[model samples]
Target: MRYKLIPFLLLTGSLHAQQTSVLFIGNSYTYANDLPNTLRQLALSLGDTVTVASSTPGGYQFVQHANYAPTLTAIASQPWDHVVLQEQSQLGALPFPVTTTQASAAQLVDTIRAHEACSMPVFYMTWGRQNGDDLNCPDFPFMCTYQGMQDALIANYTALAEENDAFVAPVGAAWSQVRALHPLIELYSGDGSHPSPAGTYLAACVFYCTLFEESCVNATFNGFIDAATAAILRGIASEVVLDDLTAWNLDVDDVDASYTSSTNNGWNAITYTHGGAGTHLWTSSDGQSYTTPDATFVFSAGGSYTISHTYTDPCGNSDTETWVREIVVGVEELEHGMWYRVYSGVPGQLEVRGLRGGEVLTLFDAQGRSVLQKQLSRSAERVVCLPGMYFWRVNDERGNFTSGSVVVR
Candidate 1:
């Protein structure tokens, strides 16, 4: 049976506490050095949490995962955000099994979609055996040399990803890159087939970039590896993965910065709300800024205000927009003089009456941050906000404005 995960595909909520779940299906290479645990640690260091788990028999392949009851049961255990498939280290580098790997991976992909509709199956392209698999070198010509085996693995995995129209977390590519640039890093263990602590960390970094879409450059967890080596591995993963997101067939965009605002004569401030992807940054020229959502802007000499905001996705894409707001500041709307008042109805409650039609009402706390905003309905609408002492403002469609303070405690 498949368990449904709310916020299945996209990581739900901008809050860091909400975790995305990932499953690694492979052999000892994935379980070696506790790779899934390393991935989770790295994610946490970056202020992102990923609930991770893995199933790996000593030398399991895609066919094994597809056929084995335990592995299939693990896949159905929860609606994972990304289900990673790693074929036995040497299979994809071979001829017929290369095609077999593709078919098996596709079958698992279909199964994943059948169960968790939003889950994405990622081909965990593993690297070549250290110095080539001497045990299999006699049977496979490419296994005779390291570079040759790596080349074949790359070709096979890329082909599989293209054929299945799936995502590939190029961990193998990242490994090859590190080997070329930092030959002394020692990614392999004494046995040559399994990964060293550094190797698993590098794999974890690649997955971090692939799944989380964020730079792992500053991640604090270095595993049992040294800081310098960790930094180099992180750099390699970023250069290979983050730089060419499209290569992995990902469609990423800047964070959403949708908002609403009101500019009226009496309020003496701009009642604004940041409802879109909650806010990476909210500000404009002249040094006005608000770091959080729902903020108020008080004009110096009310005329017009140019507002702009920017938001960035975890993938590093950013979007920004600017608009102009006209503020009459009661120049004509309140020329005859007007007055309004706020009253506390009950503990942690307040009420307002005589509001102009289509007016935007906002409440701001002592710190000048906008706490509440609503499009009022002429009569009255209870504006709910945190219990506190706050100043309120109202701006009607006709440019009429009113302002005062109220307390709810």
Candidate 2:
């Protein structure tokens, strides 16, 4: 449970990166209770930073934001790490597929990606009308009931995120969880669509968990909501979000690592286990040396070695893990192709073994950007990679080989 942040990979204008710039694009659900400012204050109370700004027009949908001058201006103002898109409360579940929202969101994602490829487009999954949407009930009977509308909203937001490979903030799901557990809490205003102060605090908690990949239970922000109500909402939000982060497509900066060493012909075989499918890298005992992210390690020495693991999620957030132990090792045969990993990266020459002749080797950066390439004619090769996270894939002529990540620094 105790851990440190992996070396962070963020898009910032300067080197002193401490917080994420988040742009909220929605209507009253976001602007009510000054949600963006509330989130910023919450992050500050928790000793974290989140630069927040928003373009929230009352009753505006994604389609509306798509052409809204204020929205476009805010987006072009900076390279945002995350863009939270909240659809109009009632528009989530309409009579038709709501093709306009879909088109607008996709178009926004494309536009954002054009400027910052790492910028994540997060869909804000809103809650249902407290009672129901009587206005659209005649067109959609499903909207006649609160639960029915909630279900449809969940489906719509989820499909939107899935189709765009975007992230979703399941505030609606958290709202449902809270309603089921603590129905007395007022999450909605009298009109039934807009969020009450309590609801906005709950939304802030969910955002804290989603953006920071940490529990919001201990956060100090309660906004205008009372302590008792805030605590309850915080607990519900934290539980719902952290319990199954993958459901919300959130990747926490945590990893599980274990290593084993054996005195096999003087070869100490070290292995580590880290949760999730993110990219990883390990630091050697010297504290100055590192290896490409690897599950297993081999050392041809007799002494103690401490390896620190740094894992990065798809969006480039990082988590750190450390393992220390003593081991003995002996020279062994180089297993080419199967072992085409970082053998030793020292000085001017970076040594990598495990590639067969007639195989093509390619290296890619953490951003999936191609950095290096080579054709192998020997069982071993010394490929050059700058200081960063990279992976090498071998293709046999038409493309068939193994790939593994390697770290240069």
Candidate 3:
């Protein structure tokens, strides 16, 4: 199974723009620099469309938002593609806060599902304070350092997302990376708690990749920062989200490009019967293409042909599978002067020739169910009632059998 990746490719005239709608429900961490608008601008720069709405108060928590009328109203307003939930920066990191954080998250998730079953719940993982949680650091000594607090936040946020079958933006993970690499960038404001403009910019970049599942490295929206700094932030966001999607659960829930194929006459029918979600495209080495998930194509001659199927989810994540199939045209010989060939000379019938006398011939459908069986006193042709791929076998009096496949059109 070889995979070829076409990542972040520029849209051609044939490609339609991908559109998404998201609703952010968090506090100042989300609204400080208008993160939703920032995300919208970044998506525009990337040749995609993102519609965003938010309900963020100054200092709102999941428990508060779960019962808050305005928040509930937002969830029910429209069928959002995703609804992001961010807990208070400190609450998720606190020791034994699962009751408050997990319970409220469950309630909000249930409400979101009731409104729109397909809407995904995203947990906004925030960074730890620049200095530390001085108020709670004394009692919970682990919060005395920035690293400890960030670690705790990651664990808690991951638990919440996993529990609710949701996704995590990993903004805090990206924040930690940028801080370690460029400490002078100033991700936090003077208060050491709220985000600086750069902080929010980085957060927006994370969301851009998370919600869109596209690369943010070259996005044009810098958002109140120099291009160099913005580029750094975007790179961090891309690595944290795009590279390790499983960590944030940004990867598609399920995707399988595997397909079943059968050749009839010269036309090969390919079908993707696996369960998954994505937009599918089928392409052949013979300069043929099909947008439908299942399609059939005819070959000019019998030979090995490369057939490939690629499926891209709504979030831009994609998987591809390629197969090399051999097609035969003439009769195939099994043993000394004993040859058998399955050919379609007339419509809806298979003519078996080159068969030795006194041999039993059996025909089976694609499901391996026996449709017809008879001892051939002489070579014969049978009329197939259905148009599909069928397997056939020939058995001699000695009980040895030879099997092959044929297609009816």
Residue-wise C-alpha lDDT for candidate 1, range 1-409, written one tens digit per residue: 0112233232432343335788888989999899999999998777677888888898887887888888888889987877888889888788755357767888888887788766777788889888888877888887888888898887887777777666778888999999998999999999887899999999999988888666789888899999999999999998898897777754322245645333232435544554444346767555688867555676777567778877654333467778886666455446214333355555666666665557787889899888788887757556556677787787767675666566664
In what order do the candidates fall by lDDT, top score first?
3, 1, 2
Give the per-residue lDDT digits (tens) of candidate 2, residues 92-205.
Answer: 876435457788888887877777767778889999898889998888899998999999888888878877877788899999998898899989987888889999999998
Instruction: Tell me the TM-score of model 2.
Output: 0.66
What value of lDDT does candidate 3 attain over all alpha carbons? 0.77
Candidate 1 — worst ten consecutive residues by lDDT sum? 1-10
lDDT of 2: 0.72
Error of 3 at 6 (Å): 18
Clashing residue pairs in candidate 3 (N, C-alpha, C atoms within 3 angstroms):
none
Models, CA RMSD each: 14.6, 10.6, 10.8
Model 2 residue pairs with clashes = 266-329, 266-330, 267-329, 267-330, 292-407, 336-354, 337-354
Using TM-score as the measure, name the better of candidate 1 and candidate 2.
2
Q: What lDDT does model 1 reach?
A: 0.74
Tell me the TM-score of model 1: 0.58
RMSD of 1: 14.6
1-409 per-residue lDDT for model 3 (tens digits): 0011323456543243466888999999888878899888887776677888999998888999999999999999988888999998889788644348888889999999988777889999999998889988988888888999999999988878888888888999999998899999999988999999899999999988887676788688788999999999998899889887888876535455765323232223322322235587878888888777555666667789898888876544567889886666563423433545555556777777766678887889878899988777666656555777777777777665566666665
